[model samples]
Target: MDLDAFVSAHYGEWEHLRALSSRRTLSGAGADELLDLYQRAATHLSLLRSAAPDPAVLQYLSTVLAKARTASLRRRTLSWSRVADFVVRDLPAVLYRTRWWWIGTALVNVVVAVLLGTWVARNPSVQTSFISPAAAQQLVNHDFSNYYSQYGGADFATHVWTNNVWVAALCIAFGVLGFPIAYVLWNNVVNVGVQGGIMVAYGHGSEFFGLILPHGILELTAVFVAAGSGLRLFWSWVEPGARTRADAMAHEGRSMVVVVLGLIGVLLVSGAIEAFVTPSGLPTFARVGIGVLAELAFLAYVFVLGRRAVREGFTGDVVAEDRSATRPTAA
Candidate 1:
């Protein structure tokens, strides 16, 4: 392995790789040539490392190869156009298809929350158990309402978004394990119900609704969606139907990822309402109305756009091209 001779023979190939990598644009032929040159250069580098290696020569080849790899990956990266396509076509379709899973979760949670709140409000003992009489009175009198206005609007919005997103993410991440999803939903529902009961018991029921509903409706819906998606993922493995267990889980996992990303955006809207609108000087009707409108808009997106997408044969799964090839096996 004569290092000088080796460099002399492969230097041109390395230079070609470097030139192509440095180019701002490449034609089809030029791109093919660049790839070919890159492969050859990589081989040369490997040979240099394994055979008679010179520090300077090896350094040069390595640098050129690195640049070529970067350029190749940049060309393959997703463009803004692909992002738009996913948002318009893929995301809503999956949400629509999985609506049943999360919708039921939402209804059950709502019922439990209302019942718990009523029970707690009607029982002084339960209310006292949740919080001291003094603290409960304080929350009912001031703290509950004060929370909305304590921070600046923008800061509050960011804090609320982050916290809600964390909860939503936990629901999805733990939903697969079955019990965790139930636990998370139970904790959230009880917390809401308990707070409502405390407020109502103290004679600020209107204030509680006014403060909570503006953000709670959408925020809780997002959490329920995550929980539902998680439960569906668990079911995919439990009752895999005709597909292999692995295949069913893979499909549901990918679709749930889409739901998680979409919920980030949804939680952002709810956070903004909680921070800015809920605490604003608007009347209770108008504030609650805005929240209702936002909730309805999300439902429309899931049902209208999602249903249409499903009817067009979208299942919220990745395109066949992107999924693993199915291997043939003995029946």
Candidate 2:
């Protein structure tokens, strides 16, 4: 049959398959039938392409193919809706499985911060070069100390919450731009380093802990998590793995989103503490203890509760049976 004739004859069946694919669960037989039909259609198209028919016939075939492709894509999008649920549900499981990666990234950030601190201690002038004179002067003049003292006020807490949320959102959003994630990570790492250096420079290394540790640990840890999520998102686009780039990206995007959400949660809590608790003239040990408890709680949620919730949501039963035995195995 001619390409146009073949397509016209099968068009209704194609539409039916397309519709079936949109449903949440397709029976094995239904999936098989759809695949069989697709293969037949593909064979016909291949034959038509090889024939190099008249321009009019080619044009008609092209239109039909385009329509079929569009219908197929629509169905795939619908199918992805089901897959997306699994993605969201299994996110904590995925992150737990990849804990080493997250830990490594955070350790790197901390190490870099320490190294920067050491470098600044050795060469005090480098601080002036890195930060503006006005900013450096402010740091030297205990402006941060004053700011933290007033930080726990209602207005200051609101401001900190708003600003930190913006930063967390930007880290996740810019990750979609591929290369920009690198810049985001670099900026965050350097900021941490500078903060560490400034604390040591002011001879308030211990006092700095009292002022910063209450919120800094959680806030900084969240930043690392944000950076890791960005990296995962970028890797999805650049997929160096076995899967195609598009497939890899779709898979990674799901897990990355969970990480981002978790980071946002951490940021919110950290911002509240930074604004309200840090400025309360709390003792160093009290701040450190609070910070440790908060950090431990976050870890528990991320690694334990989150993981269990995901597994419970997505896990399916496996049924096994011996064909020769007349009894079925309980799932």
Candidate 3:
């Protein structure tokens, strides 16, 4: 086979296929021409491989065939169906899957915060280290409570949402490294502890709980979820069990996308509560009740809807067709 002669004979059809594949829209006639070109290109590919076997020509023709095949096949488009499936299955399943990571994180951190708050309250030296006596008094007396209502509800909500989401985003983004997430958690709970301790020491414990619980319950829970998801990402590569480290990292990383998106919604709700309910004239019980309900609703979403999705073999991962190829397992 004369390679140059064969290429001269069939290059037009391959080029034509390439052109058609690159097109965004095609007419009926153009579509028919594309299919014809696709078939001819496939044949040309086979002939070149068997006879001429020129690497460059064979490679070009192979690429044309692949593009033509893909262009002719049905392309998946976004629709309500896909969005619904993602919300109902993908997001919740991911939340459910990483529940323990964040829950345990929350538990340990909360205990740490409580213990630290107690220590701070008892030790005048520790309290002064955080702030001078005058500043501490100011924070407990007026600054702490006034912070909630200073801005209008809408503005405050947006600010709080943006800030909380930023924190959550950092936790999710740095999940692989591990220690950065611990530092973020440390900064977060320490702030909570310092303020709570100051409020308690100043004889405003009830006021502290009243102002904080309304949004803190859900807001802090969302933060915990983000941190937990990050910790799990770290653990995925560390203790991949049967899977290789890269495979585990890839699988968990994809699922973290769902968790990241879901946390945005969670944080939004908590922000709203912080801005409106926390500062409203509503009774403390009513405000805190709302927060509790929101928290419970989220828990039910994970344990109920999330569990159902899991039972159906959902792993918070994209569909098998969409994700990377799974490694073959040995018996």
Candidate 4:
């Protein structure tokens, strides 16, 4: 079809043009072809805009421009480095912006941990009491001390990393269900509480800290982030602000997708540490130091670095200043 006829036919179908442009194949030849077509369309649009062509022709030109813009964006997005940059830059911003949810989840975890600690501190026997007698006997008979000694080996590292990744992904995925967040929190609380009770019962509270705290700070923080994302999803359904529930959920899901992916990175790093480093029978003070440092780094990232990056995103440049200026003032 001739350019004028093509424009006339497609002028109002900007969305269709955009979809077609974004489907350009990912290859050197494909990219070159798409870029060439985009440039041609853009040039045509500029000429049409200047000429003040008929409304239909102008509409068609607008579709061409829209398609070109879409193609350009798709090309940029498909770059490996662009993917990495998005992960590093935008992911943190998403987490930072929704940090109140993260904080609430973290506080919930801390309360659970503290309550377990208190319970153990009160009833020393409950730790052993809560577990099955057979389990307690098996644990007492097994050389758990030696098992702990070998905990940070390669196999353990692989297992921890895999398990943590699975858990993190599940937490995010299950957020689609309204009750999954609650289920995750309940399970985590029980596991942590039971573990704490076990440590105190076995007179291994201090030893447990040395084993867990180094990586627990990062590991648990990752869980909290996941929980926060899930909570945000739940809140969208229950308390949509100025939007239909479906619309709010969709919007929140877009934001949480990035946050959930970022939390996966955190889980991977934390899992590696938990598997290979934390179980090395390190000194309590050293473990605590590492934990504290990790906590500080997370706080700085979420509250400072991440927030600053988001603020920098707003450049105060008016994208449609002419259109705004020409529009009539509202009554």
- Top candidate on TM-score is 1
Q: What residue runs in model 2 are displaced by over 4 Å at the alpha carbon?
A: 1-91, 131-137, 240-242, 309-331
> Of the pair 2 and 3, which is ahead by TM-score?
3
- The model with the greatest lDDT is 3
Model 2, range 37-73, lDDT digits (tens) per residue? 6666566557767774556655654555554555444
TM agreement with the true structure for every prediction: 0.82, 0.62, 0.80, 0.67
For candidate 3, report its TM-score.
0.80
| lDDT (Cα, tens digit) per residue for candidate 3, span 68-131 | 8888984666899998988899888998888889999999999999999999888888999999
TM-score of model 1 (CA atoms): 0.82
- Position 7, candidate 3: lDDT: 84
lDDT of 3 at 292: 96
Q: Which RMSD values do the candidates have, in order?
A: 4.2, 11.7, 8.3, 11.3
Clashing pairs in 1: none
Residues 121-186, model 4: lDDT tens digits: 467477556776567545544533455445546677677767776777677777778577778778
Off by over 4 Å in 3: 1-73
Query: What local lDDT score does residue 273 receive in model 4, on the 0 to 100 scale?
Result: 70
Off by over 4 Å in 1: 1-35, 40-75, 327-331
Cα shift from native, residue 294, model 2 (Å): 0.6
**Which candidate, 1 or 2, has the higher TM-score?**
1
- Error (Å) of candidate 1 at residue 42 is 4.9
Ranking of candidates on lDDT, top first:
3, 1, 4, 2
Q: Per-residue error at 296 for model 4, in Å? A: 1.8
